[model samples]
Target: MQQPGYFAEDVLPLLASLPTWPQPSRKGATRDAEWILWVKMRMWNRLKAQFTGIIESDFKEQGLEEEDLAWIAGGLVDAGSATSTANFHNIVLYLAACPDVQATAAKEIAAVVGDDRAPAMSDVSPLPYVWACIEVLHRNTMPPWAIRHFTDADVTHKGFVSPKCPAVVCDTVALQFDEERYPDSFAFRPERYLGHTEFAGDYAAMADAQPRDHWTFGAGWRVCPGTRPAKSNLALMLANILWAFEIRPPTGAEKGGKGSAIDLSDDAFDMYPLRQARPFKAGFCLRLMLQEGLTVEAAF
Candidate 1:
């Protein structure tokens, strides 16, 4: 059992006494489960040791006296919160603005989830279109650049050589929008991920060989371990939101012939120029929260 909530209440308050600015607010609703798991299972000793010599004795990092545990905790918090917000916001904008995609997802949800109380994690597999939609959102709107990385050793690309030890920024645009990987990368078509219709053969092979789950969660050791929870949150939120409401453009706006296709410019202010849709108003109407186990005759 992943009893992270209990660990947070019992374990975290004691760590603030250490010499770090502060551990981010890791309340029940706002904590990362993996982070808590690591702290509970792996790093419990450091917390128990506090300023004691147990840390100094066991883990000598580059001959340093003690490890900075607070910074580690902060990094986990930083990774989980902001990126999750951006991902969820981007998904909502795409779903609301693209009615075709939204309809497809809703139809899938209706068929699989079926006038349910609410969508659950188990329903994710049955909703592969929903999965593709999420992937498209990631591929289309990942951060303009990835976070900085330090070079471990000298590396050469083609004829040019980057020095052995300078920090380098990844060309996120080139990598994400690689024509070989994502044909017509600019267009928001989830079917490319599903490899259906016109996007058969190479695209399908690419989709299967290595699905572009995107570098937003990052890669390898620095990878965000919160992906499971993040996907769950996104999937459930999208399923329930689309299931419960009909999203429409604001009143008086001329919604081009197919009013569903709205302009999704990132005009909203962000702490670091985030990829968010502009503040366009969407009118949501109350739709039937379909009930399960009640047939037509039974309901009547």
Candidate 2:
């Protein structure tokens, strides 16, 4: 069924703007803009209506209010869509920038999932190299900071005192790039994660003694609920994309002879509350031609 697809365009910017603390003066303006967008776009209203219908038909006994249901559903949609899109964009950019890495992932996907159909969830377990690539890319491209968390009661760690009720942001980039944990720290090498089969969420859950894979998903009770699904979907997407096409940066001539060349460096990213790769040219060459109307299930 057709559904609203404008959350990225309408709601994400509002959400992102709400947390920006670059200047204390802009806080009021940001909230005003959010309210204006909420009224003008009515994206949340549309979602609320859709959810209301579902609850009326199937969950009337739960006594759930439409506003509560809408907020719950909207939270999931907003949380998943923006982050996932940014992540997928970052993956494509990384693949385009590093052809060798892409080639390695493609080979792994090819060995695990033949050209019969698109990749499926079942193929994820056998594709460790591809997962490594994703892990490395995520480490490099995740948002510099995580969602702001509050201090619960007065807390002291590392000899710093944080008063309760103040917003505390987890510095994700700093943790991920710690030289002690990630040797060389700045290089994009999937080899670091190779043979490491645990997902980020798994590592987040381990005891303090157990070395975690990455902090991209945060930790503790506030860890991203979509961690496992996001990883599976990413692996599936990487596999399918590698199976279907070869990704490359634009040609020198197309890039205006280095004057405006695609930037594979960290400078190409916009590090706000979310990490988003700026627009860059990339070429995708089709590597496989599937039968018309073919589905992943058809391969079985």
Candidate 3:
């Protein structure tokens, strides 16, 4: 299936003219512009059809206004895409750091997807470990704060009264690693969210109310609506990448692997200005044969 995009080449610039939207200068858009631009055109057409009519508001018949259109464009371009992109970066870093996990996922992809075609949504049902890696990535690298939420009514929970009309911040790090819920919260364990069959459909239910898998996408009514899409994108992306190439740390004259070149320094996780992940380096060499890699399918 084709992915969605923000908007048209010209219409996007017009929408982005809003004060809130950042007008990023177009520089070197041609490094790989041919296919990239074509893909974007298709995506833009897909999204354009959805915005022609009144956008579905939070109930109540509020017609789509100019401001609403701007908000929609902003939400599509930044709010949703940024976090998912960040998650992708974090997942890549995790796989580069942990070769064993990457190898396991690669094995799974080879078995289920084979070498003929790339991974797809249908292949997701059997690729639990790959999905588990995504879960682990979410748990390990969560946004410091989820989208700020406001309480609608005076509610009390665990002995505190959150009065109505007050902004609330979910301490995701604390909630995710609470000693009660997760025994070894600090450790990276994808298996924590695994064991359930058809995890693609099951994991989201676990995240609602009280998060079971991870807290990267937040929770409750205001939770990220792109949660499922983000996961699906992450899974398919990882599968496709692993299927085509064997990613490893840059090697040098020192003989063996020099370990992951990924730097998780202050600059690395400096998730400000749209939570953009700083660039990092990793080795990607095309694997000659994809199906040749298999390790006696161990049912975990």
Candidate 4:
């Protein structure tokens, strides 16, 4: 996991201590499952410690008390890293499977962010196609459910009515795939979002933004606080990746098979509350060497 720049110094040790999952073995599937919870617990403990340290040392002037630390740590891990990792996993899977989309995005990135320098936030304006690809991926792979709201009182929307209820789920899968909203929705077509300047958060904020960009970031007053940084980080990552390498699925020889095919279906993802692509392979060939004077931090 990449540490947030502002807190990198304080959290570097925590990043180093992150747990590694046991490798899958012929007889280890069941055994690995039993220990996965333990690994997750260890990870959370390390993260919580790191967050507390940062809060006490770095943000001491903010006047936050000890009791607030656990809640903040949980939010940082669950609301930030987990979702970003899943999004990135989906991006790589889609790019490897769709060579044409990959090529188009790379071409656009090359035009706007030449090999002389790393991609910067300034390049976002001219790279609509790349953003479109990202939007499509977000729409397709969004969690099956968004934040669940318990009714504070009776309410109705459109034709449906609800009395006080324990939970009301906004079915993300249904909303994203509705044929009226996204024609031929299952196909990975970035063209649908061409000329759209708004990020997912922009759409989420609006009461009625036609051709809603995406719902990966939950909508309304409770929308994620990390949306802006997430968008910038995602753009920079994708731009730098396309600018520096050619992404493709592994060849048949590499897989020890006559032919190789990347699965781009629902079967490719694991059964997780947050959608995550299962481990798969993609090949990256260098296109442009790292430019002079670009630090590792800037390059990423």
**Global lDDT scores for all candidate models:** 0.58, 0.71, 0.63, 0.69
* Tens-digit per-residue lDDT, 1-300, candidate 1: 223334443466676565443444444324476565555445434554553443344445445332355444445565667666777766666666687888888888888888756788778767778777776766643455655678788778798788877767656567667888878776778887664221212232353436444555554345546656666566677787777766654443364533444565444323244565544555565556233321121000
User: What order do candidates take by TM-score, descending?
Assistant: 2, 4, 3, 1
What lDDT tens digits, residue by residue, belong to model 3 across residues 9-42?
3445574565443443233233345555555555
Give the C-alpha miss distance for residue 87 in model 2, angstroms.
1.3
- Measured by lDDT, the strongest candidate is 2
Task: Report the C-alpha displacement of residue 271, candidate 3, in angstroms.
Answer: 3.8
Alpha carbon lDDT of residue 268, candidate 4?
Answer: 88
In model 2, which range of ten residues has the least summed lDDT?
291-300
Candidate 2 lDDT, 97-153, residue by residue in tens: 677888888888888888788888888999999888778867753556677688779
TM-score of each: 0.63, 0.73, 0.68, 0.70
lDDT of 3: 0.63
lDDT of 4 at 79: 72
Regions of model 3 farther than 4 Å from truth: 1-49, 53-64, 140-142, 196-211, 254-268, 273-277, 289-300
Q: What is the lDDT for 50 in model 3?
A: 69
After aligning candidate 1 to the native by TM-score, how far in Å is the CA of 54 from where it should be? 16
